[model samples]
Target: MNVAASIADFETLPRLQRARGAGRIAVGQIAGRTRLRTLFQEGCAKIRLPRPTGPAVEAVLINTSGGLTGGDVVEWQAEAQAGSRLSITTQACERIYRSSGGAAELTTRLRVAASAHIDWLPQETILFGQSRLERSLDIELEGDATLTALEAVLIGREAMGEAARDACLSDNWRIRRDGRLIHAEATRLTGADIERDASSLLAGCNAFATLVSIAPDAEARLEKLRPFLATLPHAGASAMGERLVLRFLAPTGIALRRSLQPAIAALSGAGSVPRLWTI
Candidate 1:
């Protein structure tokens, strides 16, 4: 075998390239105003701080790689100091493309100090046929800290008449208050789970979302949310102690947002949805 010829042939062969990114941000109160204290970004992960219209500092996350596929990894971290307010949202929907072999992974970690509030309102995540994604969210809160979080998933593009005939998703969430676990949930769904017609499952719906709020007044918002939830086709809200959760299902993303926008506005401590959600 000729050495130069063999080397050239090896370089011609196809190779798989994966995406990786990580970002971190911290905010604190500075002389009665919330301000950014620390910011970090690496790889394709980016953080942008827009001017605040109110007391809360807004941070927008961007994935410069455009989309994710098999073997991709991304991580995010956020911190809010005592008496500070922070709100975070994504620049747009996250797209998950079909994987050739391995599954993509996404992880998020958050910390809220005493008397602080953090709102995590990322946009919907859309998955295509044969796509595989694993996601985990972990949060820690101190005394009287508040958190509002939303996660939505779309099976496929409704406008293109697409369906996630073959896909896989594994999601996990854990929230703790003052070192005590307050909420924990795990969700796993395969193509077969999406095909089931059972009501307890997706029920043939292509879109779904879960919203959660943990605050001192969480239960107080239940009654105010019920009237609005009743107007939507498939929306429900329940409160237990200081935790409130809402679930929504719709045939399309538009219908799902119709209910989600209002519900978020009510539960969000700022009394309005994140500006990015409208834009």
Candidate 2:
């Protein structure tokens, strides 16, 4: 009986502000050099490609919205066609601010065609007190394609005197080759006791990093990577078949990066660290 009036009222109702964005990129080999095939970006998600590095392509991801909070969502996708090589890194660390309610969300999807390679090397994600974040990373590989990924997290900034005692985080990663899942892991952190628990995975560490690589030479690189990891206060490396995994934990962000940078450079396709890391 009052359908029109109700519809108008609903349409005029105030809505809570939220940040939303999505970005995608595809690369293909052309005359032995990787080149951009397609690129798309919207809202706060943006992708920038600096000058090419030899035959491989390097891309930098940027979040123009600055930081994320409750009700915010962002997504990114990258593809490497057959015989191509692509490396991606973020312009700076991602910051998660205090959330009033709900949770900030992030998703990333990667595809590697036959004989292709993709390196995902985003910077650290910093979590502030009372922040909430959920992140997922899914990857698909075909034939002998390869992938190298790195994820680093800072619970709080020691230099700034910040603490993440009340922060919440949930992260999941899945990797599939030939349509079969080869790697899967989930991590969750909640409550103020996380930092103080002696048996906790973090063990009082405020910063942590993880690196996973899948390639024909992945296992071979394990030995070389071990030395770099050994120098860290808390670090480990392991290899199985074509996959290599490494983890590092430290009391401060500065301490974590001291050894983490060299380890990444050793495994990087270019055998050098990303430029943004130095900046």
For model 2, residues 107-201, the per-residue Cα lDDT tens digits are: 99999999998889999999999999999999999999988899999987787898778889899999999999999988788855844356447
For model 1, residues 129-198, the per-residue Cα lDDT tens digits are 8999999999999999999999999988998999886878999999999889999998877888535456
Predicted structure 1: clash tally: 0
What do the candidate models score in CA lDDT, each in turn? 0.91, 0.89
How much lDDT does candidate 2 score?
0.89
lDDT of 1: 0.91
Highest-TM-score candidate: 1
Superposition TM-score, candidate 2 onto the true structure: 0.93
- The stretch of ten residues in a row with the least summed lDDT in candidate 2 is 191-200
What would the TM-scores of all predictions be? 0.95, 0.93
